[model samples]
Target: MNHRCPAVLVHGWRSHPGIWNRLAPVLSDTAVPFWRFDHTAMQGAGTETIALALRDYIRAKREETGYTGPVDIVCHSMGTCIARYLLEVLDGDAREEQVRQLVGIGPPNNGSAMAELFNDPERGPEVIRRLVGVFVPEDYDPGDDTIVQEFRPRSRTIAALRRAGTRDDIAYRILLGANLTATPAFFPVFSGKTWEFAPDGGWRTTYAGDGIVPHSDSLLPGAQVDVFPTDPANLARNPELYCHTILPKNPELVARVRDYLTLSARPAARTPPRS
Candidate 1:
């Protein structure tokens, strides 16, 4: 009998397992059983706390299934940072378990500029107001959101992640959305561009993002990165569906994720010798 590695699904902050409703079946069809990590109950918990819980959850699943091998992690947004804390910080130092691949969709790998924007003294309120009902809620306070605070560009948690760096043994794949047309329908909040903090402490917008996380925040050294809708025509068709909030259910992204998760399972093709 062949051994199939399990896939762990981690959703971002303020998100639920239902986000995986579309992607799960595709993975299931590939014979990969997915274990969804639901963090909704742990609202207001810090990333470290959630990461520890994640560790415990993975251990319990391993014990239950008696499979002690490597597992692939598929995460989105803040969940990517949480999973990184587990696999690169705690588990990386302890050398306990193994993770074959860390596939992140619209990940805030370098800490989130949106988080920083939300905490800004001058522009914070207006920013929050714009995102309300679309990305956040009415009267949402960044100060009250623990996970948001932790993912800020200057947060201690992000500093720790920078110190730990990525694990050499695990493969990292990043998928980010792009609004090539800069259409308002893509993401009405910021006029279809992602907000980013400049080196000079000023704010700027860029189309190389998913209306939430910019490409600059998602790029990690040694990680394979790909931008979605390689064809601009797709975004031109249904611009709103490619935003950061809806990436998990995006048909293009789901298919790409399925391909990444099942890559190892497929037998490698024979290489022809040079003539």
Candidate 2:
């Protein structure tokens, strides 16, 4: 292990490393080397598949960096699920302990009702297929399964992963958006205004959440929760603010994450990527 451990950044579903465009500079300023973990961007790849791939990536990074100790993880959206599985489910006690801190930005830790909208068997799947086209390029094949299919509230995969719960050894910070219409009316309505059946089969009260995930769902039982700032105009109508897609673009949010790493993590030597 090097004198310091590096931080790993994992992007959310249907997203690529480019999403870190804004946060990268902030992390660099902290003097801690960071790496981005990219997946196939196919939500249907399955959570276990993604978690295993992350495990492999972490192992490779460890070997290449010669840092056997735990590293920090910063994940956005569904990426939080994958990181949790890697740390709490797949990794051994010794290896899991190496994870120093985890910061989840707009993470759907519980589950998002939005997924159920498109994952519905009758008409939802088709809407999902069409929606996938809008986000990914034509060449990208999401196959039969989709991330939307997995993210539906009360999905089997999410249930399985939730069994392990968040690790107490790792420090966690969950950042959620509080507004639904901060941008413009034309923007898709992803705010927490929607509600879904809870695990107990009761209807959850609807409130403002990040455009994609409700603030309540974004929360973890033990992790610290920080609501992102809302647009100045929407403050009155929308006390809670921030959209799912814009999590990385917020300067204040990025600075907060950077500050966490700066204070919580020490600088580590750079490691070259494997050829």
Candidate 3:
């Protein structure tokens, strides 16, 4: 498909442009021209900082590519948070119109409890509190801070963003990671005693969710939602679907993104014949 507008790929927290390395070729395969957004220090950068950087990138892309049409956006994790701020919070009439569709991979659209888990001074361990603070900025006044404030479940920024929802002129697609059977070994280390044994009686703990953001938190209120299996083995076997970390490499995801960009859909996957 010959896209009139360029597709922009935004990487989430503590990430670089290299995150798109696996996904870019698939987009190119469909003849979709794309751009990767580069930003600094997800660990330290606030939401406003990331938003302004994205704004600059959009402006630069428009000038450099000389494309007057709307740009399609693809984002992962916290990158979607930044994109939402740009779309819902920023006041740019022309820029707003220039966004055609937004495809988010593993976004915390409704805010993540993970933030509140750490930000809760009364309950959260002191060490974890400091570490979590790096990613989530604190809310001081009624309407300030940046990344941290915006991601807390009950924060003013998140509530406002939720109320705004997606723009009428823009289309949205949200991909979710549903299974959370696997978690990093370090999660236990950081979780302290936060993880408890299941009352249902098994060798397992509670469903920790995608190892990061919970599945429920990933859904945007008004967007079309697509759920992918989050079991690592299933993801590995499918190769076409993804968990949060490898979303860009998921073949199914790449195809959907291409379809979204081209304004067309690939035929539904056919079931293989039983031997």
The number of the candidate with the highest lDDT is: 1
Each model's lDDT comes to: 0.86, 0.66, 0.64
Q: What's model 3's overall lDDT? A: 0.64
How far residue 118's Cα lies from its native spot in candidate 2, in Å, is 1.7
User: What C-alpha lDDT does candidate 2 achieve relative to the native structure?
Assistant: 0.66
What are the TM-scores, per candidate, against the unseen true structure? 0.94, 0.77, 0.73
Better of 1 and 3 by TM-score: 1
Model 3 lDDT at residue 186? 18
Task: Flag the better candidate by lDDT, 1 or 3.
Answer: 1
| Ranked candidates, highest TM-score first | 1, 2, 3
Ranking by lDDT: 1, 2, 3
lDDT digits (tens) for residues 1-275 of candidate 3: 36545889999866688988877887777778899998855445677678888888888888897778888889988888788888887743444447888888878787755555555565445535444443333532212325655687777767767776678777788775534333333133333111222346212222333445555566665677765542346633543244456676666677677777888863332211111
Best by TM-score: 1
Angstrom error of the Cα, residue 223, model 3: value is 0.8
Clashing pairs in 3: 47-147, 136-148, 137-148
